[model samples]
Target: MSNIIGFNNAIFWTDDTEILYCEFSNTDPNAKLESTKAKLYIKAITTLCKGKAMPFVIDLTETCGTFTTSVAKFIVRNSELKKLRISESFIIGTTGVKLLITLYKKFYDPATPFRIFADQNLAQAYSLETKQKYHNSIKKVVEDYK
Candidate 1:
């Protein structure tokens, strides 16, 4: 499931990869994302995760950072969805001021770690590596039990 625009500020996902890509529109400064869409985005992510922790690579390349809070609020409101732990969140090109905010969040929610990078490639690579390690750890546990 992928290529969904104006739905959640998120864009793509594929079966082969463990990355969820979110892009807040750089072109439209006043792009309004309704609350319903925010809920849907959370729903979509939870469904995609299928009862496992999932990491996201958010591309905040060029956009006012308003819509992000809406999504966060929805996640906070849902008690059952708390188990949808974000293994990692890589935000691209949010340096200087936004970087500080992200840093605070990193410490605030240590359970779901995150990294900031100027380059999307680096973020994606690290996300893939983290994802692999998670899968390997889970696999080892299952094998041991078997």
Candidate 2:
């Protein structure tokens, strides 16, 4: 079984494998990432994580555009989110995104552990292994996009 939640531009879900998954699309390449949108997305993810430590896999292969430094900082420094997330995060993306993540890692200290991958299957496998190691099985509350 699986649970899905999303907006028009992104989606968050989980399958029986017990990994939290996120995918992005329909993003404006020219637009800066809005803080409100970022917060909303985090709220959705927080709900899915159910305050339990779990592995996360984010598919950024189709995501376009850039977010503000403040948004990135919030994601990396937020104490509440840090507490909710456990295990390593796997990000699936292009070389550019991987470089961005590398730069972010170089400049700022993140609260959660993460790695970037070009292959989704590899990311999934990594997350699955993490989930198994953590023995996490948090149930997600899925909602339809309005």
Candidate 3:
């Protein structure tokens, strides 16, 4: 029963509160994905996540940006916030992706599972885990109704 609510470039999937899956394809450079959109998504999910033992996977594989310092800070803030809510959180950036891990080295916390994979397998694995969690939640609800 996992659902993704999105519009244009921003997408938020609901499966794991601790682990939110998001992808931003900047259709226009001026819009700036890091603005309110990214922050809202983070705040919304964090509020919903509460105390779930979930992790996060932010897929920036299709993103295109200047990778400015501001955007990097936004990503870092959200990543750290996710970790605080979940057991752990990781950001998955593909080869030649938009977000640059090096730029945020100063703010990078080793305790958080920050990583970049050559491909989307790691993100996919996280999504599958979220799906399973959703399925179980739904099953439990159905059993309760029965």
Candidate 4:
């Protein structure tokens, strides 16, 4: 697990899935969310996968942070983002939250697949399916080489 920039949260990584789990609690209302850690985590996955599929499953079940313009752009530019499974636990119909959701939906292309899950278990199951596909591809490549 990698700590957030401000040590407010910790990102948990797993070889079973590309999901980044951040467990946060009682964060400041107006505090700025540092995404550098998230960026670094994504970079790590990209490096490990080496251009292969790296779908993201963000279990944001306990944190609240406005997705700034820079983060939005980052999400758009990450080509390996096959799926984004976000947990909609704290986010309600607030103005800022709505705006962020609208921006993501507007900017994200239809070809890019994404979904919001209510719990981590469902998200993990979906991630497993994606991992299986990736594993199959690797197996095929190895067999071809043989």
Candidate of highest lDDT: 2
Which RMSD values do the candidates have, in order?
A: 3.8, 8.3, 7.7, 5.7
What is the TM-score (0 to 1) of candidate 2? 0.79
Better of 1 and 3 by TM-score: 1
Instruction: Output the worst ten-in-a-row residue range by lDDT, candidate 2.
Output: 137-146
Candidate 3 per-residue lDDT, tens place, 36-116, comes to 666677665665455443555555656655445576567566653645333222344443342445344435534444455
Estimate the lDDT of model 1.
Answer: 0.62
Model 4 steric clash pairs: none
Clashing pairs in 3: 19-55
Which stretches of candidate 2 lie above 4 Å from their native place?
88-93, 109-111, 134-146
Which has the better lDDT: candidate 1, or candidate 2? Answer: 2
Residue 29 shift from truth in candidate 2, angstroms: 2.5
lDDT values of the candidates?
Answer: 0.62, 0.72, 0.54, 0.51
Better of 1 and 3 by lDDT: 1
Error of 4 at 90 (Å): 12
How big is the positional error of residue 22 in model 3, measured in Å on the Cα after superposition? 1.4
- What tens-digit string does per-residue lDDT give for candidate 1 at 1-146? 44343443455453556576666554565665567777776776666666766667767676544445655556555654566555555455545436644644654454565677767888788788777777898899999999
Shift in Å, residue 44, candidate 3: 3.1
Most TM-score-accurate candidate: 2
* TM-score of decoy 3: 0.57
TM-score of each: 0.68, 0.79, 0.57, 0.56
lDDT score for candidate 3 against the true structure: 0.54
Q: Model 3 Cα displacement at 117 (Å)?
A: 1.8
